[model samples]
Target: MSKVVLITGASSGIGKSIAIFLTEKGYNVYGTSRNPKNIESFPFKLIALDVLKVDTINDAVNFIIKQEGKLDILINNAGMGITGPIEDTPTDEMRAVFNTNLFGAIDVMKAVLPQMRQQKSGVIVNVTSIAGYMGLPFRGLYSATKGALETITEATSMEVKPFGIKVVCVAPGDFATNIAAGRYHTPVFENSAYKENYQMNLDLMDAHVSEGMDPIEMAKAVHRIIETKNPKIHYKLGGFLEKFSIVLKRILPDRVYEKMLMNHYKL
Candidate 1:
């Protein structure tokens, strides 16, 4: 039988691209949405699953196992974006993103591990962000969420290896998606200390997303990783500069890298 796959946040954007691509490749793909009823149709199976809700996560995982007998791959792609100066960003909102991006992803992995463990094999790919590797000016909350997930993936991969399971993190740079529409934007308050610079950085961020590479490229990258015999713990998919920035950070002095980012954002 073809590999059974589950992908979260598949109503649109990168998750949708990956689901469709994998379905076309003959994998038994099950994509998820917070409101599956809202989506009239999808190329593969689209189910209701809100990552913030552990019950929904468990139900979805159980439903898949019942239908497929076994799940071979899981693409933990559900996440949201938040942008604002760290001080201006609401504490509750920061916690909300963490719940969805980090805790929720972990919960899903927990739900699947038993079945995967019993089967003696499985692969979990967590979709992170290139922004996670650095503290971007107005996107500190978003960066932190993905960054935390990256670390979790590293630890989880080692823990599950003996179970014949694989865990990987695929961090993508800006991709032309409707993420901006869904992001929680802390309003640009006129009296706020970061008003001018924050607004400028927000505009710059939107422009970058609008001009970003195709989501299909991300799908292709995931496909390649899934097919590998021994995939690396972390993989980054982005433009040359975006990926290189991580490398530069490793080799450059602290102040030097900070200066480069400040110059890039004109802060």
Candidate 2:
């Protein structure tokens, strides 16, 4: 029997690409979006799901369980990005990002684990970002969400290993996708201190994301992660410079890393 896989935020971008790629490879794929109607002409089934809502998550999983008998893989890829300084970002706005990026991912993982535990085998992949490892200029909150998810993914792997469930984090650098269209640009105040630098950094960040790696590359990384029996706890998928930056951050001094970031972002 073909393995059953479920992915969240499947309306577009990396999530959508992964779903299509996996489906073409003969995995029984189910993708989720807040509105199933938005996913037009998808190869796999589009399940209505709002990751922030527990009931919708449960319903989506239950539907999959009923149809496939077991969920062999799950990609917690639903997330959003926001741009603003830490102080300039409103508490409610920060919560909204975390709601979908962190809490929502965890909630879905919770909903799916029982079955994986029962079956004694499953793969859970969380789509994080390169920003998770290093703080970005105006996208601090977005970085925080991904960073938190990465840590959670680590902890989850340790806890669930006995059940034969593998939890992995795939941190992709920028990719060519509609993510910028959905990105929340925090309101800039006329007299705000961070107005100039914030605007400059935000524009640069948007441009980088628009011209970054292909989404198919990320999809292929997910494919490899699922196919491998013993996948690593974390996988960084992106360009050479992007992946190199992670290594630099670990080896370089704090001040040097800070300077590199400031120069790159023109902060």
Candidate 3:
């Protein structure tokens, strides 16, 4: 039998691309969305699953287990984006993003682990971002959330290894997606101190997304990870500069790396 796969936040963007690709590859795929009903058509089954709600997460996971007997893979792709100056961004909004990106992803993993442990074999891929490796101007909250998830993935991987379950992170660079549309962008207040620089960085971010690589690359990477016998703890996919930036951070002094990022963002 083909491996049964579950992907969260599959209504569009990278998650949708992965769901469709896996389905075509003959995997039994179930994609989740906060409002799966809103989407009239999808290549694979779309189920209602809001990551913020534990009830919804449990319900969706249970429903999948009932239908498939076992879930062989989980693509924890559900996440939201936030962008603004640290001072201007609301603390409440920061908590909300953390809830969805870090806590929310953790909840889904908790819901799946029992069943995966029972099966004695499974793969869980947490879809993080290349930004997770380094903080970016205006996108600090988004980076922090993904970075937290990366650390969690490392801890969980070791814990679940005894059960023959694998947990890994796939961090993708900017992809051409509707993520910008869904992102919570703090408005550019005319009197705000960061008004000019914040707005400029926001535009730069959108342009990067528009010119980003296809989401299919992420799909391909996830597919490869699921098939690997002993997958690495982390896998990063992005353009040469994006991937190289991570390396640069490792080799460069703290202030030097910070300066390089400032220069890149024209901060």
Clashes of each: 0, 0, 0
State TM-scores per candidate.
0.99, 0.98, 0.99
Is candidate 1 or 2 superior in lDDT?
1
In terms of lDDT, the poorest run of 10 residues in model 3 is: 34-43
Model 3 regions lying over 4 Å from their true place: none
Question: How much lDDT does candidate 2 score?
Answer: 0.93
Alpha-carbon lDDT of model 3 = 0.95
lDDT for each residue of candidate 2 in 180-239, tens digit (9 for 90 to 100): 889888888898899999888877877888889899999999999999989999999888
Candidate 1 — which residues are off by over 4 angstroms?
A: none
Cα lDDT, model 2, residue 244: 96
lDDT of 1 at 20: 97
Positional deviation of 27 in candidate 2, in angstroms? Answer: 0.4
Minimal lDDT window, size 10, model 2: 33-42
